[model samples]
Target: MATSGPVLLVSQAQQRKSRTYTPSPWGDFFLHHVPCTPSQLLSMKERAKVKEQQVRQIIHETIASSDLLHVFEKFRDESGAIVSGDDASCLLMLHDAAHARTHGEEILDGIVAWSKSRLQSLVVQKNLLEPELAEEVRCALETPRFRRVKRVEARRYIPVYEKKSTRDETILEFAKLDYNISQAIYCDELKELTIMVELHFWMLGVIHDPYCSRIMIVKIFVFISLFDDLMDNYSTTEESNVFTAAMERWDEQMAQQLPAGLKALLVRIFNATNKIEEELKLQGNMHAELIKKMVINSAKFYHAEVKWRDEHFVPTSLEEHLQKSIPTSACMQMANLALVSLGNVTTREDVEWVFTFPKIIRGACIVGRIANDIVSHEREQASSDHVASTVQTCMKQYNVTIKEANEKLRAVIEEAWMDIVQDSLEQERPRALLDIAINVARVADFMYKREDAYTLSFVIKDIIASMYIYSV
Candidate 1:
């Protein structure tokens, strides 16, 4: 019998080597299949144009290390809460390759190593039949040289947008306003849910013409929904987690559309989530109202999508998924639902923007949790339940098995936030809208520094930077 370990690594490596020149399986999978309108594509270009300018100005300005320190050191009324939110968002957002460049080069190397390790783990778990493909993924993920060039491009991309339109000025101002609004929003647990509401409408706002491309717009919506579900609970409990709600809302529609094999896969996923929910007895009390509203609206969105597909309606440039979900009767005054419903409206109504604010804040919360989990995933497994015992579980997880991966992630988060801040400042960019994201990265760095789990290397700083993204 052949040894599985070496055989797996060699196969994965070869695949990675072969696939480097072509589009990645994951990339191709996402690009063609994901739904979005033409208007959404135009919106993405607009956002990207604006984002590019913000990034460029940051690169050109003589930003002092002291300015960076000052921003990090500043205190707010809800300093603790702000810090927590900031750390989580940064972790979630900057887990990409491009932003990993601000730190020294080793962090990129570490990502490659981690990808390789993931391939190895997949083999051990029997999740990979084609080890060569796994190796290919590892190779693609390992491209430090590529990442470096991308970073330069990203930096250059921001400045070119400075000349675009007056909309840039207005957006920059709005971002600054979000700083105060975000802090206020986060202070009240009820108000925090507003984050989701705004993001959804942001999706809606991109509907320019029927023929406009809406890939970026739709991507944001889908991402927010998936992320919201992931953050709420990975389990499939009926008590009402994000996953359970979405499943309930979209199950039939998705099921009818899917082929038999895919439908079976969906059923299994649903069953698994439900089982997890049962095992955990996951409390819906914390996010009950928010879950209810999200479920109702999500169901509505799915309902409309199904109708359009069933009728074979002329593909409207903008889908009317938004039209079906609104005017929920769920009372927000009830504390349980109030907190949940705080930031979850589906309209672009004046009050709706506040509702979506919490998604970003909540995203930060979840990202922080994810980072902590990265530190502790292994140890938690040995426990009777795979529950985390410490706040710094991610740090702990990094220390024991994948120290370098954790370091790389942290560095990326830090650099990403700094770059965003620089862009916001230099281009009059919308820094405030991304407050939660920036704060998440900042607090993560602070936490890591205090924990001293790993060496304070340049690579670690880079991961932390990549965590910051501009929502402006």
Candidate 2:
């Protein structure tokens, strides 16, 4: 039921009043936009594809050569061959070679076993390896690249690629530039987002990896954040009702009575929706109607919250708050937006599964909503104007102290994650789609684990620096 497209900003008076809110230390740097044109996006995509092909070719050639196999064979015959267990470079080669789809018959099964045994011996002996190589060995042992998060794998391999003397300098340079460009685009979108809604783009880029995918994530969250602020702080009961009706109607003619800011926001949302629809159409998807329905449903939920606040009413029980919170959280809408970048890989059936509110998706929404409330409840209560957060509702319903309520909510968050993992195993859906749901919860944990990191940027400065300023 959550909405999509660009979000509308709060009234100018409300914005001025909220200026007392703490701003990020990196505000100045983040605000300076570095525009990335369509051509640049296309070029980066092409470069990434070409680099991937080159890496594949290099792996294929290394596997075909018998030099590494001969070394392994020599060690296999000796009682104590002194094979360097810290040879991650060699281990990586073996891992990829064993998994190669099309390869000349060189018999890699024995080599894989021999290499794995030595690696295990190194682990048993607690042998010291360079930190980078040590982590690589641990990851290879624990989770193969195929099952690992793509961004983590990319970050880990970039350093390995740089260490090789035969590595193509030009490709490495291009990769570095591509990364910087991506960071810049993220910053530009984030700056515009922060003007109305306090949020971060770090986790989105990490999970999505691709440039276009990251952009879509930023767009979706930006709108969600702004809409949340409007419902929570800016709109009155009458204004909220009028706005909701206009959104449900979804026509320019219905927007005439809206305030200036709401009018502008509606126009922006429609523009963004149109743009997304065109892109999806080009990709042979018919998602415009579904997205429109989602936006309208989200507005209806927003109106419900406004009515509750206006009537000075609190939910009678915790379950009541959850029923409303699930749709209002907007996690499902965000998940669908992320999937748009996946193109034909996501089938119509996959989209239907998302809409059905399966356990994995429901668990993610619960985590996102409760985690945010756990950290931000006191701050929201201080305002005395916001709708009842889950933390407060639980305290009132159970007649417990704030500390006790938070402890129970924390337990609920943990249980939700367990449900997500269990459901992921049982479901037959695409792993990529499931990962999107998991990543939403992960991002929520990152944003609110210590405090309301999304609202106060200082808490997440180090994370932002590592993701943007420093390269792997």
Candidate 3:
């Protein structure tokens, strides 16, 4: 049968509408609309570039004004050194804007090439400062520089926590994952990834505050992610296979190719996750521990559920098993991490009090992600005899379907956000940039399909927010 003109027009209109409404993390971070195809995306790049130029022109014109020049000098002493890295990065942003505007579709690719050179140069220049430090950095760089960069020689895993790599395989994996999930997601584009790394430098520049230099912040993210994965196994369904593939790609192949530093950094992330688990178990946070334990347990449940379905071994109803599996411990486990992350509030009571807020956020994340997975695999779910949190089962229990769950999840997330605001205000914390960044991550997470995004953001934001508020 031949397709009609009206159908084609309608299809085009829907596609356009979808692009506009997509909750993309990259779009949110860059403050632009999500792109649908390579061609459309190239067009968006040109548009972004043009806008960047306009921004640069405004900044240049402002700097040229006498008042601004005077203020810049006044802010510095007589033997004033050059502007700091923070300022340099800001200037780079302006430059990026101009390039984006001027270069059109070439802006992203050009910027990426430029950044790789810049990173290499930065490493070379650092070598000039101290040969020993530079050599150590180079060695580590040969390891795991994707999520982290090389730091001074420390035999023990020093949690380097940078950002992901920008290689083809990594990009392709992220793109495929995002597409398969049918949700707005963010992957580390070359520019964004560079900016994320530069952010570490920016913090060190503006506030040579020792805490800013500590390993605590990076470790927190790693721990929170592991904890989230443990607790939210149900939300994963078929989507887990995609992530598993990505991990396998990293371990089997990508790990072999990265700089020594990057490879070590990836190894450190896993070590850190295990360490956190040990510490939590020692502290007797049973709820959190159980979540980790249950990933393996849930798999067993699926196996048993399948056997029951096949042989009709009616030991207990599937509903009973499901209910038993979802322990009330999740709320408490989430609360523990949230309080710990909020730097200023460390005691048991402080953590206990904040537990309520984390629970709400956890629920939102689980429900939102689980619903998304079901929607994406609606047909697969129909065919599977036994699957965790499938749409059919979800509808049976809640009297609502996937879309309804997403809406409800959104409302829950909003409510928990207010609690976060209230907690910060009550604690009288200073809303530092780190805290704000954590909150931004939390908000940006809604644009992604990762179940961990919500849980990680909650812990990150709560911790940073509490640090500002509690002053500990």
Say which candidate scores most in lDDT: 2
lDDT score, candidate 2: 0.66
Deviation of model 2 at 218, angstroms: 2.7
lDDT of 1 by residue, 49-94 (tens): 5655675675566464336443322322353322222231122222
Per TM-score, the best of the predicted structures is 2
Superior by lDDT: candidate 1 or candidate 2: 2
Instruction: Flag regions of model 1 displaced more than 4 Å.
Output: 1-370, 383-401, 426-431, 443-472
- After superposition, which runs of candidate 2 have C-alpha atoms over 4 Å from their true positions? 1-206
Candidate 2, after superposition: displacement of residue 86 in Å? 23
* 44-109: candidate 3 lDDT, tens digit per residue: 455545555655666677678746333333323456532333232332332233222212334333
- Residue 20's lDDT in candidate 1: 12
Model 3 residue 442 CA deviation in Å: 2.7
Candidates by TM-score, descending order: 2, 3, 1
lDDT of 2 at 79: 56
Higher-scoring candidate on lDDT, 1 or 3? 3
